[model samples]
Structure formats: C-alpha cells, structure tokens
Target chain A: MTPLDFVVSLALISVAAGVLGSLVGLGGGVVIVPVLTIFYGVNIRLAIGASIVSVIATSSGAAAAYVRERMTNLRAGMFLEVATTTGALSGAYLATLLPERFLFAFFGVVLAYSSVITYRKRHEDQLLAVSNDRIANYFNLHGSYYDEAEGREITYKVSGTKLGLVLMYIAGLVSALLGIGSGALKVPAMDGAMHLPMKVSTATSNFMIGVTAAASAGVYFIRGQIDPIIAAPVAAGVLLGATFGARVLGRITSRTIRLLFVGVLVVISLEMLQKGLFP
Target chain B: MMTRQSPGPDPQKNVTPEGDLQVSGRHRNLSPAQVAAMEEKIRKIEFAISLVLRVGVILSVSVIAIGLGVMFYHHGDYTSITGHASYKTLTSRSTPFPHSLGQLRRSLVHGDGRGIVVLGVFLLILTPILRVAVGVVSFFYEKDVPMALVTLFVLVVLIASFFLAGL
Candidate 1:
C-alpha cells in the first residue's frame, strides 16, 4: 500500500480504538499495539511507542471534556496520582527484575475477579450517601455531577481511600511493567474499592492515566522508540475519537457505562490470560 | 436506587453557617447557596485544567497533522522510501530517531517531516505534565494546601521519572 493509504487506514482503526478506549476509560494502547504489530507488521518497539502516544491522546482528549462537565472527581484523581506515579517509578526498576509471564498471569486473574464484581454491580450505581473515611474527608474527595441520563444531580461520598491508593499503586506498576495504560485496573479501584459513582470512576480514571503515561513517555521519546510516521496518524486519530467519546459519555446512563466497562474488562482479562499462559 | 439518609440526628442543623467551610466526611448538609459557591470554586479549577488539556491536545494534533502532510509531500509513497537501503536502517529498532530538543530544532529548521512529527509527539507527552502543573496551581489558588502539596509531589515524581529513565 501507498504511504497515504497506510496512514489513512491506521488512522481510521485508531479512531475506533479511541472511541472504545475513552468510553471505557482504557487507553487506546490495548488496540493500537496488536493492530500495529499483527496487521501493519510494525516493529514491536515502534508499536509500543505509538501506543504510548495514543494513550496520552485519548486521555487528554477525553479528559478535557470530562473535567469541564464536572464528571471527574479531580481531587480523588490528583490524590491517587500520588500513589500511581510513585508506583510507576518503582515499577520501571522492577520491570527488569520480575518474570513477565507470572506478572501477566497474576494480573489477569485479578482483572477477571474484578470483572465479575463489576458485572454483578452493573445495575447498581454505588453512590454512597455518607462515607466515614477520614482520609477521603480530609482530602475533600467527595463529588457530585449532573447525570444526563438520570436527569438529576447525583451527589456521592468517597470511601476506601486507603484501599484506593494501594490499588492505584498496583495499577501504575502493572502499566509500567506491561507497557500498557492499564485503566482496567484503575476503574475497578475507584468503582469497587472507593465507592465512586460509575461515571465518576471512569472519568477520573481517564483524567489520571495521562499523567501516568506521560511519566514514562519521556523515556520512550529519548530512547527513539517513538516513530514519527507511525505515531502521527495514531495520535491525531485517537484524539479525534476520544473527543467524540467524551461527548457521548455524559448522555449515557451509568448502568450502560458499567456494562460496557465490564465487557471490556472481560476481553482484556482474556487477552492477558492468553499472553500469560501461551508466552 | 435507595437514597440512604444520613445516619445521625444531623449535627449540621444547629451548626453555624461557618460550619460549611469546615472539612467534613459528608457535604450533604451544605445549604444550597453554599453548595453553589463551592461548586463555583470547583468549576473554576476544573475549567482551568480543562482549558490546559484542550489546548495541549489541539496544538499537538495540529502539528502532527501538518507533519503527516509534509511527509507525504516529501516521500510520496512508503514503497519508494523503503526501496532505499538507508530507509531500512532508519526504521530499525536499533537506530533511534532525532529525539532531543537540539536535534528536533535542527530537523525543523530543515523542515524534516519525521522531526516535525516527533516534535508533536514531544508536545503530546508534555501535555499531561502541564496539566499536573496546572493542578498544583489550581489547588494553591483554592487554598487547599495539603492537596497542593500532594499535587506538587506527583509533579516532582514525574520529573524524577525522566532522570530515572536515563539511569
């Protein structure tokens, strides 16, 4: 194919990835990596570089709208970021020491378990009316948003602040080690552990992933793994798609969002399992 | 969904209006006016952060799009570029791209497509870091000192990651 054809086709595929990614709070890396390597025959390193670019693209693109809409729990996100960033710093070191297959298999099981939990809670939006978590209270992590689908303002309390921080650290570590954004882990940490409303968890997760990814992006850039031609179309396409997804998110019900997230979680778990068992 | 009532005989009922400013486990008792004021403050912070993110994405994507155009104009087709032996070596994993700021500057001066695209990617990577910096400033503006410190710590760690990568 001509260069233009490759660019256009890759861009189109990335748009789809971006849409699904932003909607579910997973970055486009999950789709971009395999597609680039398997279909386009791009080098694995370059594909990862492109995936990194797309992760940031999807996050920043979608998060801009989520924050503006007040769907994102910004304080919770920022606070959790403290843990994620630190986890990433250590994960970078651990990446060289740990066995990849074992880590993948372990994380896969964790995701599968979380997916089940998420599925069971799909119909129920867990917006706690009161939380006694002192850490969350002191940090002012509680939030409220106008749910377009429910057509009412939903105010919620945040709980499990300590647990949320622990999970976020693991999420950051996994993403750094695996070279994927790992928003799947982040969503569950907020939704299940912290009792954030489904939309708030998704939006807040979306807001935080960019910062986590950016922490490693500089390294990838310096290493020259980021191929310009491969990343250009992917970044631009994902940005467009994520922007569109962010707009659609507010209109959708929390139940629908939870269901979609559960589906993605199952698929990601399966993929992780395959990589672990097969590799 | 069942709306659960606050579990106690509401201490907030007799509390003075100044109680609204005190940190609490639940914000359920804030009067509508206080809620509005709080929401306004939060909105301003969100707006600032959102604006930063939106601007960053737009700027980076525009540069990348322009870079793609330049690439196509220069090379015409992927096949022709690959036909050259140098192209093979250039695309290999072992050989890194012009990634540093100085190299980027030189390449842009010459209007190199790949260099321009890398610059865009660089900008894209910087966006989230910029957003975190904005977060620190926003928290400071709100007089949320502890949260500001937390954000600053994250920012410090992020900058530290770059140096760690070098090691």
Candidate 2:
C-alpha cells in the first residue's frame, strides 16, 4: 500500500478500535499497538508511542464528561496518582533499557491477563460490617455519588488502602512499560481491593489514567518514540471514535458483540506472543 | 447499596467542614448557600477542564490533518514515506522530530507539515498536564488543602519527569 493508504488505514482501524473499546469498556490504545506493530510492520516502540498518546487523548476526552457529572472522586484519584506517577517514572526508565523482544512478550502477557480480568465482573462487597482504617480516614478515601440508574445516592467506604497503593504502583509501572493506560488493573484495585463501587471505580480510574499516562508520555516524547505521523492520526482517530462510542454505548446491549471483541483480543494476544517468542 | 450505620468514630471528625464539603461520604451540616457555591465552583472547574480538553484535541487534530494534507499536496506521492519517513528512518533519532525547541519553532514558522504534526502531538500530550494544573487550583478553591497539595505533587512529578527524560 502507498504511504497515504497506510496512514489512512491505520487511522480507520484506530477509529474502529476506539469504538469497540469504549463500548466494551476497554481503551483503544491496547488494540492500536498490536495492529500497528503486527499488521502494519511499524516498529513496536513507535506503535507504543502512538498508543500512549491515544490513551491520554481518550482519557481526557472521557474524563471531561465524568468530572462534570461529579462521578469522579477527585481525592481518590489524586491520592492514587502519587503511586502511579512514581511507578511510571521507574517504568519509563526501565523501558529504555529493556530489549524489544522482551517488551513484546511483556505486552502479550499483560494483554492476556487484562482480557481475563475484563471477562470477569467484580461483585460488590456485601458485608457492610466493616471498620474504616486510619489511613483511609486521614486521606478521606470514602466517597458518595448519585447513581442515575439506581436513582439514589450511594455511599461507600474504602478499605484496604495499603493494598490499593501497592497495586496502583504496579499499574503505573505497567502503563509506562507497555505504553498503554493501566486502567484494567486500576479499576480492579479500586473496586475489588479497595471496595469502591463500580461507578466510582470506573470514574476515578479514568481520572487517574491521564495523570499516570502523562507521567510517562513526556518520557516517551524525549525518548523519540512519538512519531507525529503515527501519533497524530492515532490520537485523532481514537478520540473521535471514543467520543462516538460513548454516545452509542447506552443505547446498545449486544452481548454477542462484546464476546466477539474479547475473542479478537485473544487472537491479537496470541499474535503478539508469537512475534515475541520467535523474533 | 449496603448503608450500615458506622458506629465507628464521630462522622463529624471525618467530615472537615471546610475541606470536605464536596464529598458526601459523611453527613455535615452545610448551608444551602455553601452547597450552591461549592456546586458552582465544581461546575466552573469542570467547564474549564472540558474546554481545555476539547480545544486541545480539536486544535491538534486540525493542525495534524492540515499537515497531512500539505504533505500530500506538496509531495503528491509516497516518496517521503519511502525515503525519509520510514519506521527505520524515523526511529534512528535520539529525540523526536524537529530535535530541539528552536528547531520546532523554525519549522513551524516555515509551515513545515512535519513540524506542525509534531506540535499537534505535543499539544495533545499537554492536555492532561493542563488539566492537572487546573485540578490543583480547583482543589484549592474547594478548600481541600490536602488534595490540592497532592495534586500539586502529581504536577511536580509530571514536569520533573519531562525534563528528566532529557537525561
């Protein structure tokens, strides 16, 4: 294909990924990197750089709506950001040192792990007979939000503060290393480990991903991974697709589409793993 | 959905009347005016963030799209991609295209499409940092000193890493 054709195709794929990702509650960055690297023969580093930029774009795009709705817990996001940012620093530093093959393998494994986590829904903790720890109280980790679906204000207390911090550190690390937003890990940490409600966990994770991705995005820029030709289209396409996807998300309830998306992720994961293992 | 009465500590202690007004985790005696002002403050902050994000994305996309158009218009072929814009060629640089701030400025002034694309990506990256900066001010406006400090700390890390990436 011609260069123009190549660029346009990548952009179109990004738009499709963004649409499916937002609909399935996955971010487009994950889908973009593998497509660019495996299909288009773009260098993995350059693909990752573009993916990271797309991640930030989509995060900021979605976050504006969430923040306006008062669904995002600002304190929780900021508090966890400390760990994610620091971890992102270390991860980016390591990215420059790691071998390309190893990076590819790591991405594959992380993708598989993320897919499994995505398949399982987190059940809300029912035991309210719990006590608040001092650190949580001091940091004011607890929050309440008006759930439009339930039509009531739901108040939830946060627990396992220490675990959440440690997990967030890992999430940040993985984010920079792979050049994808680690929302997959962050949401579970907040929802399952910290006992936050699903809506709060999703919103807070969205709020935090931008900051976490930003911490490493700068590093990628200086490292020269961000090819404007690749990054510009990827970012623009994903933002457009994600915005459109979010709008359509509420209207559709297609279980088959969701399952098909997961199947595609699995296939992509295997492709990445094969590339890494062989090359 | 389980709202058990926490007989733990006084909810009053948990609720800082000044800093914790926005959060409804614990009950606090707040006046209607206080709530309205807080809501207004939040609405303003959200509006600011929304504007920053939307403008940044739109501006960047427009510039990059224009750059692509110019690249296609002037070259009229895939020669640049084959010759200089290949993955192998682009990846050889130790820093991103345009190399330095001065170089970027010069190229942008010359209306070089590549430079414009770089600037667009740079703006997209900046959107999050800008939002975080706005967050610090909004947190302070809410009288949430601790959260503001936390946000400030995140901002510091962001900037520090950007410069440190030079090393």
| Highest-scoring model, TM-score | 1
Per prediction, the TM-score for chain B is 0.69, 0.71
Off by over 4 Å in 1: B1-45, B79-96
- Candidate 1 per-residue C-alpha lDDT over A131-233 given as tens digits, one digit per residue, 9 for 90 to 100: 7788887766766778888899887778998998999999889877887736988999999999998988888888788889888776777767788878888
Please tell me the interface RMSD, in Å, for model 1: 5.9
Give each prediction's DockQ, rounded to 2 decimals. Answer: 0.39, 0.33
> How high is the DockQ of candidate 1?
0.39
Please state how well chain A of candidate 2 matches the true chain A, as a TM-score. 0.80
Per-prediction interface RMSD in Å? 5.9, 6.0
Candidate 2 colliding pairs, count: 0
Screening candidate 2 with a backbone cut-off below 3 angstroms (N, C-alpha, C), the clashing residue pairs are none
lDDT of 2: 0.68
Worst 10 residues of 1 chain A by lDDT: A1-10
